[model samples]
Target: MLNTHLIMEQIRYHPIVATISIAVGTVLASEVIWKVVQYFRSKREKANRVHEVVVFNELGEICAAQHLWNTRPGSQEPEAAHCRNTHCTLRNVGKIAEQIDRAVYSIDLAIYTFTSFSLADALKRALQRDVSIRIISDGEMVFSSGSQITMLARLGVPVRVPITTYMMHNKFCIIDGVERVEEIRQLRKRKWMRPCYSIAVSGSVNWTRQGLGGNWENCIITADEKLTAMFQAEFNRMWKAFEKTEASLIQPK
Candidate 1:
């Protein structure tokens, strides 16, 4: 009994060591909690960004543009246009249709290879809506099997072809003179430039099924009037040059 009492009474706790251990434990726990919170926050922010890059649908509904790549999947990078991939999943034909459908006045298109039925349908629809529609296509491909030249011509849409030894390889469509309805979203931000029109899309995509659906391609969507003007100028130059030679060069497709 005497030995047991003395042993118990002599036993003491070290406050400094215990307190330091508790403090260290609290710090480690706090760090873990902070890391967990940051992980969730990063996920939430990424989802928001994915939802932000979007385009307007035919029915006036805003939705994320359907993007795809051919060789590799989209890089899933934040704040980028996904053009770095060899192929992109951007819904080319549909987005063009939406841009044309929203056209209040006119649409001028310069395409290298136009073979998309869906795009032809959109052009027809635009013509029906009384939008002034003009198209410039490569001379050789205009009469090809999948070419839309004949269909567009039948729809009363004026179609032109270049008559040079070199290829007219421009691929873009200008809506309402200043509406640059480009498809590829440019990765480089034009700090001096901001949006000028309501809709614009442009990139490496052609109106062909392979170009839009299958090939390794890139495109951009923008609404800058300056860019529109530049593209429109190129279209005008080509259109006029083709017209000068068209009277002698034009043939039934």
Candidate 2:
């Protein structure tokens, strides 16, 4: 049988045993301290992290003016006055434009009816900054009045339209660093990793005046790697299927 009392007495008196016990205790305390530090660091990082999913709504007093103008007979004057001050303040459109403005690498836009000049200007600025942009629009809608597709194409930005008669009514945009996102996804296949700074914006908010400002619409902006990758794949597939011949030519005004 082990002499537990005797061993304790030796440990209590022996300098070597006391030093070893203190060293072990110090190591254990250090490990616990390190673990506590890591836990708080992780918690802080999570607290300071940006939102993965952001939602924008096109409703309320902003759209109410347009609604009043359309529904009531004598409300046009007041509505017009309200609209004159508020028409340029569409938050959803501003958000979309902000995404365009922030593009460091690329922007792939697949919109149905793109008549918003502000958005078109945003694309132009991105083009000027050498950010690669590809636009795919509805074939018929590309020729519609107020459509900025032709103007964009004329500025040397690549634009394409589906050859099919059915409307290409997809309203989504894949923005920034898609290649980095793909690289991170491939890394995740082997081990866990953080998502890259790629963004995919989708929903009913078209790149049009009425869609962004007047209509009831919703937009979702996500930094989810998987979802963004899926959108990137869809955009690539549509880009391949769309006819680029009309997009390359400068249309006559």
Candidate 3:
């Protein structure tokens, strides 16, 4: 049987024993408090997690069909004829442009047809901000009327044409999260936590006025890591397969 009085007397005689007991208790309590804090923090982070998939349709009501239709030659019908008394508000172009504008580090675009002035302006702005941009475009389409691929190249953006007899019919953009990754790394060094953000926007919707507002097209914007990584891999592969020489728009042939 352990004698409590005897134990107390022994501890009193050896102050180090009592000190050790208090230190051990304090350490256990701190560990329990830290675990509770971590539990609540995890719950909060899960609640605020930002994994999303957004779908955009060109023929949808959100698209401004009237503006796009007016841009078409010989389509001089009244605005009411386009939307049938509904508001012709085109938003998909702006949405895609907004995605480009949000890039902090880099943008990899592999597009079939590139003509939308809005999107070109967005890319120009991103370039002005020192954001790295690489474009892989269909060879024939790069020379098509109203194609912005050459214009982007003229602005010093690296543009490549896939060397294939068939068309490079991919319409996708990868928004890299390099800046976010660096931020997370710095935060972790300081014992902080943050979720990284990266995304891929892809679908049948080409970066064109007709595709964004006139045609029946669909595109998806997703932040899934797996999908982004796959798209990144494909972009890297094409970036290599395409000619190493950047296209020159100073003198169009």
Candidate 4:
């Protein structure tokens, strides 16, 4: 009986070991939760990478502004003053145009359509500055004048409209190696006529002024290396499949 009582007393006093084990278990559980959260946060699995991008600065703010068009109704423009500072919006395409015009080394642009006068002029100006330019468009979906392509080519911009089975529906630009899409990256090095920065934009906006002025489109403009590298890889892959027999325009050879 005495031994039994001693054993009971020991069990009651052994709470320290139980407490330590519980504490260890809690710490391990916390670590597992943290790891799980990080895993979901880092792994990218979707082309629609809207969630991956976040507003970290003024440039990010503009991108969020552009994305608002996707969330809001109609072709109405988001109020830039109210939007975050970095998010790109349809109204801010002019800013994108300006960046293109300022490109010194190289420009790689892919779009579904080309008709925006402002953007066309920007590309034209870039060519005149002797900036190396490569442009690709959906030859099958010529919604507007190939003025941007033609102008760039005439000015020595190496342009092509690759015919593809999937509609070549990508609309993007890598100016001085920056990727414009939120969370996407662009990677390439094009020597410029001047040593200036480039701009990249991606979203629903087309090259037409309508897309910029009145159409509902989501877009982001950024110079972040991490983001642009992602886009560059995609552009490179798509460009590889582009037919070499084609000119920038779909006109007869």
TM-score of each: 0.56, 0.61, 0.63, 0.53
Q: Tens digits of per-residue lDDT for model 4 on 136-238? A: 7776655355456665555555556665566778888777664322122223443332233435677776777556655555667766656667777777666
How far residue 155's Cα lies from its native spot in candidate 4, in Å, is 3.1
Ranking by lDDT: 3, 2, 1, 4
The residue-by-residue lDDT of candidate 2 on 19-135, one tens digit each, is 887799899999999999999987875553333333334433456545455556653222232344333334445656777887766788898988988788889999898777788
Better of 3 and 4 by lDDT: 3
Clashing residue pairs for model 2: none
How many collisions between residues are there in candidate 4? 27
Q: Rate the local accuracy (lDDT) of all candidates.
A: 0.62, 0.71, 0.71, 0.61
> What RMSD does each model have against the real structure?
17.7, 10.0, 8.6, 14.4
- Candidate 3 weakest lDDT stretch, 10 residues: 78-87
On lDDT, the leading prediction is: 3
Selected candidate, larger TM-score, 2 vs 3: 3
lDDT of 3 by residue, 1-253 (tens): 9799977886889889878987898999999999999999888855533354334443345534445655657653223333442324244455566678877667889999999887898998888887778888887898889999888877777777766699889999987644434543575585543343577889887888677666766677776778887888888788877765344323323
